[model samples]
Target chain A: MTINSVPSSKVRVRIGHLYGDLLNLYADRGNILVLTRRCEWRNIAVEVVSIGVGDRIGSGEFDILFMGGGQDGDQQFLEDDLFRVKADGLRGAVHDGVPVLAVCGSYQLLGHYYDPGTGPRLAGLGIFDMHTVHPGLSVRRCIGDVVVDWIGAPVGGPSSVVGFENHGGRTYIGSGARAFGRVVSGNGNNGEDGTEGVVQANAIGTYLHGSLLPKNPHLADHLIGMALARQTGSAKLEPLDDHLEWQAHQTILDRRASHVAPVGGRVKGSGGSAR
Target chain B: MRSRRLRTGFAVAMGQIAGWVSRAVGRGGGTALPGLVVDYLDPSALAHLARQLPGGVVMVTGTNGKTTTSHLIRAMLEAAGWAPIHNASGSNLSRGVLATLLRHASFTGALRVPENAIGVFETDEAAVPRVLRDTRARVLVVTNLFRDQLDRYGEVNAIAQQWRDAISALPGSHDLRLVLNADDPTVSALDGGSATTIRFGIGDPDVGRDAPDHASDANFCPVCGGRMRYIRVTYGHLGDFVCDNGHARPTPAIVATDIQADGWEGTAFTLKTPRGERRVSLPVPGLYNVYNALAGVASSEALGCDLEPIASAIGTFRGAFGRFERFTIDGRRLVMVLAKNPVGMNEALRTVVGRGGSGHHVLVALNDFDADGRDVSWIWDADFEILVGQVSCLTISGHRADDLAVRLKYAGVIGSIPSSGTVTVLGGLADALDGAVSGAPVGGTVVAMVTYTAMLELRSLLVRRGHARAYWDDAGVNSPEVTAR
Candidate 1:
C-alpha cells in the first residue's frame, strides 16, 4: 500500500528506538523494521526515531518505545546516559501508558539493577519491579529456541510466541510485576521458575531476542495495536495476510518439537548449546 | 626417540587407512577422519608429523579471509618452487590441519611429495592457541577480527586474549614472524613484542567508506577508555584511526595504494612492500580480499620468496572454493560467495549488487547447521536493507529459509520494487538452486550468497547436476573451466 493511501485523519504510530545503534546486538533492529513494515502494509504511517546515548528524548514524543539487547561494553557506555539523561523522559512516557518493549540487555536495564558479575552492579531505570544477575563466568548463558505460552496477550494475539534467546543474566520477577509468559521449552528468566519475561502495565521486558517479533507477527501486530490505541484512543487494526509469518512461526515450533525426545523426557537441543 | 618415532609411524599408517576408508565409503573428502584417527592413536601425531617438514609450517588465522589468504600463500609458495601442503578444503580446525598434513606425509612421518615442501594451514581463531602450542609455525598471518559466532566463541576480546597468550608463550628462538592487519585496531594492537611483526593495510584514502558502518566494532581505543577518531573507515571498523591517548594505526610495512576494486572484474592495487612497489591484480573482488592479498604478500615476503614471482602468482590467483567462485549452470552464470557473519555478508551483498545492478536474481541460502553457526541472529546485523528494491527476484533457501524470508520481508526487500519482485522461500537447497537457476534470465548472473554449510550443500547439488565439479577435484577458482566462464 502506498503511504499516501492512508487518510491524514488516521493517527500514525511513532516509535522511538532507544539505543538503536549501540544496543542492537541480536539484530534487534529487525523488531523495529518488522513493526514499521507491518504498520505500513496496513496503510498506517509509522515514524521511527533512533534515541542513542546522550540523545534527549521528549516525553510522550513517541507512541511506543523499543530497546534491544547490547553487549556488556556497550551497555556500560549507556548506563550513565540511561539514568541521567533519558530516565525521566522514559519514565514519563511509560507513565503515559506508551507501549515499551525491551529485550535482553535493555530488559535487564529496565529493572531495578543488573549485576554483570565483574563490575559493580549497574543501576537500572526501575521501570519494572525486577532485577537481573549474571550468575558468574562459570555459569553458561541461557540460549536456544524458546517457546513461551504468552499470558495476558492482547486481543486477537497468539497463545504462544517463539523466538531465539541468548542471555547470561537470570531475571527474577518481583512484586508489582507479573510474568509475561510461561516457558514451554528452553530456559526462561532464572531457569528455575517457569516464568519468562516481565509484564508491568504496558511495558514488556524479556530475554527473547530473535529480534522477538519477525517470527511472531501476532505479537508485533498486538504491540502496534497497543501503541496506536494509546495515541488514537481506539485500536482498529485491519488484518493483513500473515501466511509467511505464520509459516515462520510454525517452523520454529516444529524445530523445537523435533529437538525434544518424547520417551526419555530429555531435552536434546533445548539447552543453551550453539548446536 | 626411536620408540616414539615408531609410534608416530603406526599413527600415521592408521590415519592413512582411516582416510582411505572414509573416502571409499563415498562420504566426500576425508578431511577430518584421518586426523581423528591419528589424534586418537597418538595425541602428538600432528606435531610429530609437522617436525618432519624441513621448511617448517605457516599458520593463517583470523575471523575472515583465512581460507583465501592461505590458498594465495600456497600459490605463491608453489610458484617460488616450494610444494606447500595446505588444507584447501576450507577446513580450519585442528583436525582438518592434521588431516592435510597426514595426507601429504608418508607412514614414517616424512614429506612424501617433496623433501623441501612446507606446510601452510588455515586455522580457526579458537583453534589457534592449540595449534601454536603444538607446532612452532615459521609465519602466522592474522587477517582481521570481527564479532562472529558469539555462541561458539564468546566475543572478539576473548579470542584476542587467547591469541595474545599464545603469541607470548612462543619460544623466542623460534623467531615466529607475525603478519598482522595494520588497519584492524584489535589486530594491530597484538604486537606481543616477542615476535617480529609485519603489518599490512590499505593506504588508499579514496577506498574508505564515507563513515563507519552501523555495526562497526573496536571503535574504542583498547589502550584508553577514550573514543577513537577515524580519518576513514573502509568497511566496518577497518581503516585509519587514532585515539586521544596517542594510540594510532600502525604504519604497514606492506600497503596497497590506489586500489581500483571492480566488484566483478576483481581488484587492482599498487602494492608497496619493504623491498619495492609493484602493481598487483587480484582475481577476487572486495576490499577484504585486498587485505587478504596483502597478508599473503607480507607472509611470502617474510619467507624470503622473490617478490616478483609472488606478485606474478597473486596476479593470476583466483579465490578458494565458494569464495566468489563462479560457474555456468544451464547457461546461467552463478557466482557463489560464502558469508558466515555480518561483515562478510555485507561485503558479499555489496559485491553482488554493485556488479549485477538492479533487477538481478539473487539467492541467499542461510543455514543454522553446526558448521554455519546455529545462531542466525547475525543476519540482522548485516545491512540486507541495501538490497531492497534492488533485485528483481530474491530466493531464500536452507533449513532456516523462513527466518531469512521473514528478515527480507521486514527489510522491505520483497515488496519494495515498483513492480514488486518475486520473493520465494524454499526449504531445500537443491530446490532453491533449481528455482534460482531456472528463474534467472539467460546469460544473466545469479549471485548465490550462502553460509558455510549451505555452500557445501549447494556445491554438492551442482556437482550432482553436472554443473560444477566436486570441491576436491576442482583445482581452484583459476581452473581453466572456472576462468573460461
Candidate 2:
C-alpha cells in the first residue's frame, strides 16, 4: 500500500469509537480513519476494528491507540472501562514501549480525570500528567495550515510539520512533560498560543483531524518504523513502498496547500515523481 | 384593519412590482447565486413594515428536529382554532419569513389578519436572537442544542450561552416561557431567569444511558460545574437529568413517556405531563420526531392552545419538507430523510433502521463545501455505523463524494459509487429518489441525506418535477401521495 516505496507489513488498529457513539464521539473517529487510511496508502495493511459500546481492545493488539473528543458521558462510560481494560496497562505497553496516539478524549484519558471536583471525576489511563476540565467551551477550532517543530525523532530530518488543530481541552505541560509546539497559527497550550499540535516520544497526540498522517507523512513513517522496530529489533520497516500512499497523502497535501500555502508558499515537486 | 387593508392595496402593488422585477431579473431563476441574492435582500423591509399591524412573533430554534417541532407548534395553534400565521415551508430564514408576510400582507403594507392570532415561525439557530429583537415574541421556546455547522456557528456551548443572554434580555412580563430540552445541560442552563421554564424530554429511564450518543452535547451542567446526570437520552445530550448546583436538570413537568416505535417507521408515545398523559402517534420516524412533537406540544401549550388539538395535529403531522417526507418523483416512490450533520445523519440512519430493512437503495449526498462543514471530518462521526450492511447498495454523491465514499468505506461498506461528477450528484439525488420507488427485489424505500444549503437545490429540483410541494399549502389534500408513506 506504500505509494512511494516498497510495501510495509500489515498492522491492525482498532478504533474504540462506540463510546463516541454514546458519549458523543465524532472528532476522535475522524482521526482514526484519516490515520488508518494514511497508513494503508503507504501500502501498510491496516485492519481497523471500530470498537463501539461494549467493545474491548487488547494491548499489543493495536499498533497505535487512538481516541477522539466526546461529551463527558463518553468519558463517563469509559471511567471504569479504561480501568478494567487497564488503559494505563495499555499505555504501559506503549511505554514498554508501544507507540500510542491519543487525541482529545483519548489524550485527556491518558492521564488524570475530568470535571475534577464537582462532576464525576473519572479516571484516565494515566499515561501522561494531563488533566482536563469539562463544561469548557468548544472555542478552540484551528482552521487552515498547522506547522510544528519536532525536537526529538527516531529518524530525523527537518523539525517542521503541518496539520489541523481542533479541541477545547488544553494540557498545562506538567512535570517531565513539555508543550508539543507553540501555536503556529491557531490556539495551543492555554490554547491562546495558536499552538498547532503535540508530541511526546512515539505517542504523538494532536487535536488535528486531517488524518494527521496525510498531512505529515514523515510522522506516519516514523511511527510505522517505530512499531516495526519494536516487532523486528530494527528501527526501519524495510521494503517500504509508499508510492500509492504518498499520492493519497497528496490528497490532503494538495488540499491543504490550496488553503494554508506551505512554508515558502509552495513546494515545487514533480506531480508524479518523488522529490 | 379590514378598512386599512383596502387602503393599503396601492402599496401592495409596489411590493408586487418589486417581486415581479426580481423574478424578471432572474433572482428566482433557481440559480445558486439567485437564492443567495434573494436571501441577502433585507427581509426586515417586510417584517418592519408589518410590525404595527399584526400579533407579535413566536420564534423557535434548536439543532435537532426544530422543523418538525415548529410545524407541530403551528398546527397545535391552528387546531386550537386560531389563525396562526406561520412559515410551514421549513424555511427559517428572513427571506422565507418575508415571503410569508408578503403573501399575507396588502399594498399599503397593512396586514389583513385580525389581532387575535399568534405568529408561529421557526427561525434558524443563529438567527433566533436577532429575529427575536425585531419582533416582541411573548413566549420564546429554546429547544435543546447540539453541535451544528462548526464553521459558521462556533461552539455549541457558545450558542447556548448566547441563547441564555438573549432570554435574559427579553421584555419582563411577556410570559417568556423557555421550553428547554431536558437532556441537554447546555440548553437547560438558559432556562434560568425566564418567566416560565418548562422542561420536556423522553421520560422513560430505560431509554437513556449513563453516557450519551456519540454526538451528545452538554455533558455537564454549565453552571455549578456538577455532573449532569441523565435518566434517558432521546438523542445526543438530550434527556432527563439535573445538576447538583440547583442548575436546571430534566424538568419532569412536561414529559414524553412510552416513547415506542411502531414498526420504527414512526413513533407512538404517551405525552405525559402535569396536564395529563395522552397517547400520541407521530408519523415521522426516529426518537427525534418524538422530541419534535414534545417541543411542539410544549410551545402550543404556552400559547394557550388546547391539548387535544396539539395532539391531533401532531398525530396528523405528515412531516416537514425533507425532514422525513415521502414522495413519488418520476413515477418512483421514495422517502427523503435530510441528514444534515453528524448528529442529524445518525438520527436519520436510526429512523431508516427502524423502518426495518433498507430493503431499498440509500442515496446520501454529502455537500462538504462552506454550507456543509468545510471539515468533512464530521461525516466519520455520522452513525452510518448503525447501517453497515443493513441497507445495501448505497449510492453516494455531493460536493464531497470522495469524502462520503471514504466515510462509507471507513464504516466498512464497500464499493460506494462516488457520483462521477457534480451534475451527477444532482442526478444521483433524483436517481436514488427514483431508485427508491423503482421496486424490484427491494420495496419502495429510498433515503437521501442532504445538507442545509443543498436542500434548497434539492427542493427546487423536486418542486420542478412536481415530486415535492411547499408543505404549507401542500398538506391536508392536494398531496395525499406525499403522506402515503
Top candidate on TM-score is 1
The pairs that clash in candidate 1 are: none
lDDT of 2 at A86: 50
Candidate 1 lDDT, A203-247, residue by residue in tens: 888888776888888888878888888877777678888888789
lDDT of 2 by residue, A1-275 (tens): 11122346444333333344434333555555555555565566565554554455565665655555554433554567667755544666556766666655566666565544345666556566656654333232334335555545444454555444444445555565555555544444445544433455667556555445433556656666666667667655433434433443444445554654422111111110000
CAPRI tier for the interface of model 1: acceptable
The best candidate by DockQ is 1
Point to the candidate with the largest lDDT: 1
TM-score of 1: 0.91
Interface RMSD of 2: 11.7
| C-alpha RMSD for every candidate | 4.4, 9.7
lDDT tens per residue, model 2, B1-485: 55545434544454555555654664442212222232344334444543653556677888877777777876777677766666566656655555555555555565666655557767777767666666656666667677776545654765665666776776775455667776667766676545467667677766645656655566566776555666556576776666666665645467777777775357888887666778988887878777778787877766666677777887888777777777765444566777777778887777777666544466778765554655556676676767765655466666556556556655655533223311122225555444434532343455677776556566767777777664434522111121110
